[model samples]
Target: MSTVEACEAAQTCWFSCRAAALGGQTWTDGPLHWIREGAEQNLMFPTRIPADAVQSAVEEARETGVQIIGAWLGTEVDASALAAAGFERGWAPSWMAAPVADVGVSDDPRVELQEESNDYSDEYADYAEMLKLTRVRPQHTWYAAAYVEPGKAASRKLAGPRFAGRAWSHLTGETAGVFDMNVWPRFQRRGIGSGLLRAVVAAAAQAGARDAVLNATTEGRLLYETCGFRQIGAGITWWLHLEA
Candidate 1:
């Protein structure tokens, strides 16, 4: 598969895990899969783009009466078509990947890494609070539960010392997708984030993954690059706000 296709598949798997954790239903119409969160909103992701299906997916999202609709268009999809459909292109995150040997390692003594337990722990709670503080999402507690629960079964959860930060790497076949890399505000600039990333990558490699992939935010572009991850493709998410 192409890098874009591989990245999209990995992302879809991660989203599926999150949706299952929340007991949400996933439905597919044509090439698109709608991961609906009750009536609050819907995540419309296209596994494969057929001609005109993108526009139909947008129409379906509007008909759902969802106040906000988020979609990630693969590199092969035409972004302008979605824009013409009234979906505003928001932050476009870069999809990056690197071979196991290229992933950098950290030798910082203060940075200790540990695997998370199946049941929730104090570290998980602190990590959720840290995500809330950094990302400014007060509802991250629910999101955290969705991520942590699925991760325990299908991914590796790596935590830094004193729960300063954490990251998750989910592997399927030979590709591993990294997600939920968060660091406490107080722990910023202390190499904890990098340390956690190194640990996660190492775990993926040891688990027999040939490569690792992640969608990097603007704030994390440099860090991922520093760790030998290079942009293989890009994805654009369009946000459509509907009338209540």
Candidate 2:
């Protein structure tokens, strides 16, 4: 698939998995596809929204009491309508992709990786704690975390997690989605990030995914690129706060 097509597929899979994990709702209206996780959260996908549809979506969000409405707008997508609807421009995140086979693996012995299939498990609690330390909300239900001690691999039952990430199954075509990757501030340069990434990407590939994709923060773009991900598309995030 072309990079743009791959990006779209990745996004669809990410949103679908997020909906499943969060008990969220999703719907498509005209050219707009809406994914809402709660009363306060809503996101529109594929950018390229027409002005009328943007206005309509905004009006609907207001009616439904959505506190935050987010959209990743393409370079060509008009920002005027969103701005008129009270949306403020935010950071641009890159949509990235890599072939499953091309993704690099980390064999760092100090980093021990663990996967959490149950959201309520203590392992997940550890993961959530790490996420909170990084100022990320623990919204997804499933995840994996990497841990380490001075001289040995950390045990889930004995030690706290230091970094967290997770991969979603391929929900749209053959593309798997990666989300919620974060490393603790002190562990920044350690191979913990790459180890966690490889573990999840390997899991997705084993589940029959041919390609892995994710949306990368500016700070994370280089790490992902070195691990075989390349930028396919870049988009600005627009946020509309109904309460404000």
Q: Write the per-residue lDDT of candidate 1 for residues 110-195, one digit (tens) a residue.
A: 44444333334665553333332213222111111111112233334453224455677766667778888877675677666777
Q: For each candidate in the order shown, give its overall lDDT on alpha carbons.
A: 0.64, 0.65
The 10-residue segment of model 1 with minimum total lDDT is 140-149
**Residue 77 in candidate 1, Cα distance off native in Å:** 2.0
Kindly provide the TM-score of model 2 when superposed on the true structure, using C-alpha atoms.
0.75
Give the least accurate 10-residue stretch of model 2, judged by summed lDDT.
133-142
**Candidate 1: regions farther than 4 A off:** 37-67, 79-81, 104-162
lDDT of 2 by residue, 1-244 (tens): 3375666656765665556455667888877778876554555555556778878887877787777888866767767877877789998878888898898555755444343233346645533343322222322222456555533554565465433333332324566677777787766787667777776677566656688788899899888888999888877788977864
Global local distance difference test of model 1? 0.64
